[model samples]
Target: MGHQQNALHVKDLNVAVKTPKGMLPLVQNLHLELKPGKILGLAGESGSGKTVTCMALLQLLNPKTMSVKGSIQLHGRELTDLNQKKMRSVLGRDIGFIMQNPMNAFTPVYTIGNQFVETIRSHTVLTKKQAVDLAITSMEKMNLPEPSKLMKKYPFQLSGGMLQRVMIAISMCLRPSVVIADEPTTALDVTNQLQVLRELDRLRTECGTSILLISHDLGVISELADDVAVMRNGRIIETADVFQLFDHPKQEYTKQLLQARPALLLNDQLKRRVI
Candidate 1:
């Protein structure tokens, strides 16, 4: 597909951090595209620059400490040119972000309802009562128990999995065109992880939302990604359809990654395997 038709397009992207020695490259000459209603998995080991790429895409990286160079276009609009204030409006509305740690996504002092309602109100002309109703409805759709009560509870009162689901609900509630989920299931148990993954898949299918899913877990990627990109040492070495990359990887590094999967995790049938 053409660049203009893509949900997200990144070209010649480079990120570097300033160090006492000099500028140290973290990600170099990266190119990526996410089509609407598709999930693109970014798989790499820790420090492979997956999270850094997400941060740069969202303009969350500190300009003073890190240099980000590239063109990031969402639905043909250049994001790199937007100032912080304009970027804030785009975030949570146009592009949603699910952080690696859900706990850090919200303020501990605020009740879940307070934050959720405020978020809705900020994005739309909804009143407090309307926002509250919307928050409850969204949470219920995520299958969170006692949505109303959950909203009244503090962030500390919820489990990691619940918090993650809450984050997903809030992110999807706005119906953003693109979502960047950074290691969303890392902190959850197997059951919660599966639930989270299922919820993401449902939301994407229902909303036609394009997702850039960043995760070290190949299992998670295999379960959801339509396309996959393998990264090593801050650069993407291979990109292909998910099945092609898993079944017939071209790069030796990609082969090693596939081989490194636990025997139990690998099955004769890809669809039958549980993440």
Candidate 2:
């Protein structure tokens, strides 16, 4: 219904990949939730199953090799067992994805506009003109420079930051109720990162979009997360309100993450070194 009741719920989730060695378990008890208009930061080290957990949430895992077992419910709808046809409808219409590598999400052969247009046509019966207008609106919402110029360019033609913005534009253009972002700022510099984060904050506030933001950057989580889940060795060790997770971390792993954050308030020695 709201933040009080989970918008998305995961219960006793376990995931494994069949590899040459054996069935390598990746995630366990990986419970998480995303409430409407809230940012739920999912953080972990490399290979901690942060990415895999998100994939499992929507039943997007490659069933050929990866095996997942869990209960994932969005707005009380169980997704794991949804048939292929049904899941596709639910995915783009109600769920959106912003991948860690934006380039990987787009084709180098097509202009940004082409892909956006196609995506809308696939989901809803909107005219090409209508879809383009929606695409432009989404681009403007991300505060991209010269949105028209961006639409003309191919994914390879744009810089990483610009491409990442384009990816966000395309994903949100459909106005999905839920958006799962995997390191949306991975390729950005500090200035661009801050800009994107600000726009993302606006989206959460303006659209009431429930966000599952996955990142290894604790600083990003500290800035935007309403709630957080910390992962280690394929399992979540801490789940708490954003402030509590950062300020009063319960687990040793979480404490270590806080300590490793670069000291923002420079000491005399550190300042002298910088100067």
Candidate 3:
């Protein structure tokens, strides 16, 4: 889609960190676009600048130590120009972020309900009771059992899987236009991974929320992403439709990545045989 039609657009993006020597590039000349209600998967090996790209898009990196230069437009609104205060307003409301570790996403001292209600209240002018009700409702939609109970529990009390779902619920409660999910399912078990993936799929299909899904797992990307981009050494080596990239990778690096995951190929074969 064109820039005007995109839910999130990034062009000529570059990120660098200051070192004793000088500025060192971590991501360079990157371009990405997320269409409304679609998932774009970013796949790469660890240290390939995938997470750095996400941080730049969210404007979360420290400016004193890092530099992010680019045009990041969310629904045609330029985000790079916005001040920190303004960016805070846009973050959870306009763009939701799901981190790799759910535990790190929440405050250990606070109950889930406290954090959820506070987040909702901060973004919207809802009273505590109203926010509580909304949080329960959103948790229910995520298929969490005993939504009210879950809310009352502390983040440390819940399992990683449940906590991830709670995080997803919180992110989706506002129905942000775009969600930047950075390795969202990486820390979960098989069943929980599937559950998390299902919830993300439901968000795009039901809520019409666009997602930029960053993951090292090709299997996850193949399962959930509509389009895929391959990053290596601070640059995008290839990008194509999910099927096209998987079946016919153009770059040697992409080919090696696919080959490195023999189990993914085996799993695909097993499913096909069962079908």
User: Which wins on TM-score, candidate 1 or candidate 2?
Assistant: 1
lDDT of 3 by residue, 1-275 (tens): 44458999899999999999999999999999888889999999999999999999989999999999989999889999999999999999999999999999999999999999999999999989999999999999999999988878898899999999999999999999899999998999877887888888888888899999999888888888999999999999899999999999999999998877536643464345322
Give stretches of model 1 more than 4 Å off. Answer: 2-4, 262-275
Q: Any residue pairs clashing in model 1, and if so which?
A: none
- Tell how far residue 209 is off in model 3, in angstroms: 0.7
Model 2: per-residue lDDT, tens digit, 125-230? 9999999888888898888878777778888888888888888888888888888998888788766676667767777888899899999888777777899999
Whole-structure CA lDDT of model 1: 0.91
What is the C-alpha local distance difference test score of each model?
0.91, 0.83, 0.91
List, in order, the clash count of every candidate structure: 0, 0, 0
Clashes counted in candidate 2 amount to 0
Instruction: State in Å the error of residue 27, model 2.
Output: 0.5
**Please, what are the lDDT tens digits per residue for candidate 1 over residues 150-209?**
988999999999999999999988999999999999999777887888888888988999
